[model samples]
Target: MKINSTVLLTLILLILMLGAGSLSAFLGFTLGSSALKGVSTPDGRPTTKFASNKATNAQQAGLTLLKEEEILKIVKARIEGKTKAAKSEKLDEDDEETKSSKQKPEEKPQEVVEEKLQPGFPVTAENQGVTLSVQSVRYSGGDLLLKVKMQNKGADSVRFLYSFLDVTDDKGRTLSASTEGLPAELPTNGPAFSGTVSIPTALLDDVNKISLSLTDYPAQKLKLDVSNIPVARVAGLL
Candidate 1:
């Protein structure tokens, strides 16, 4: 009985060990399959969370690339616009210059007429209590300058307006004259007063002789006249 019981116990222990090993192998295979299912989709694709994250990342990258392209395009457009504007401005300036050049005409300088002066001077005239004398002559700045002196010889005072002095060329044309360094009134028995008379040489271009006449203003009582003053041509001067 003891031997039979020992054999039966050994067989029982061997069956239990086989069954436990089979169950352990099956559990390991099932757990491994479950772990694979957790990491991957049923069609062998990645998990939904991982795929969604990857797709979002790709979309963001594409958006970034598009934004970069858009920014580059905007910058290029602005640069090209500025370049075109500058070119347009330059063309407008060139057009304006061309129009201005075509519109205006050139001007010529006026001709200056010159004359010659002779040597006859120191002409004198007397009227009432006044004596008028042309003392000297000179040429300056396209004008003929005459130095003159006046004396009040009588007892009474004498008043004169040099503006009323009349000058005429040989051709009977009146000439303009300006005077300086002369007094409006000459006292009684006063010393001689010196002055200058300037006449534009342009008016004397064809004249050879001139006449001068003077009289007291308002009264017109005193009269002095000198005529036939010759001005001959001089060589080496115009």
Candidate 2:
């Protein structure tokens, strides 16, 4: 018997659809079983090997991430520690500098000492019975010292006292020494009289000269120019 063409076509389509579905199901089962076998252990038993591998991989990744985070934390802490130490050190240095800047310095006092004059000339004066001489001029502090020698060369004793001691400048301003302030005293019949005469350095200058005039000897008033002396130099007295 001859079949209708449309019905025959419909039957062929249904068979093809059924065969395609069966083939797809067979392929899916085969692939799924093959994957399962690849992940299984040697024993023919159900296994979670694939799942265990996936979990292990994920755990290893987590550990790596955790280690990296710990390293970052350590590095950050070190950097912060160094920064803090640097800041603290700078602060200490600044404090020390400030203290040094605020502190005051100590003061020292000036002391004056004595010094002798040099390159002096000898000046001599003689009378009928007494003779006087000045050999050197010395200096100490603010005073000038004169080294004088005297002698009684006559048959009788004679007393010698301070006569006139004066310093003169170009302006003729005179500063004289008094008898009460004289540094030496001559006795009667004294063979030799040796002493000093202190004159204020303020009363004289480098350009000034001193003149010792004795207008009064033992008991008589007689003017005599004993000494007219200049300073050691034109600049300083000694």
Best by lDDT: 1
Model 1 accuracy (lDDT, Cα)? 0.82
Tens digit of per-residue lDDT, candidate 2, span 1-238: 3568888999999999999999999999999998888485565434667777789898888863458889999999999999999999999999999898789566578778753434556777777666667767766787777777777655555444565454454456666554333334444566576667667777776544676656444565434456567544344545
**Colliding residue pairs in candidate 1:** none
Listed in order, each prediction's TM-score against the native is 0.47, 0.40
Q: What are the clash counts of all predictions, listed in order?
A: 0, 0
State each model's CA lDDT, in order.
0.82, 0.66
Candidate 2 clash pair list:
none
Query: Model 1, stretches more than 4 Å misplaced?
Result: 1-119, 233-238
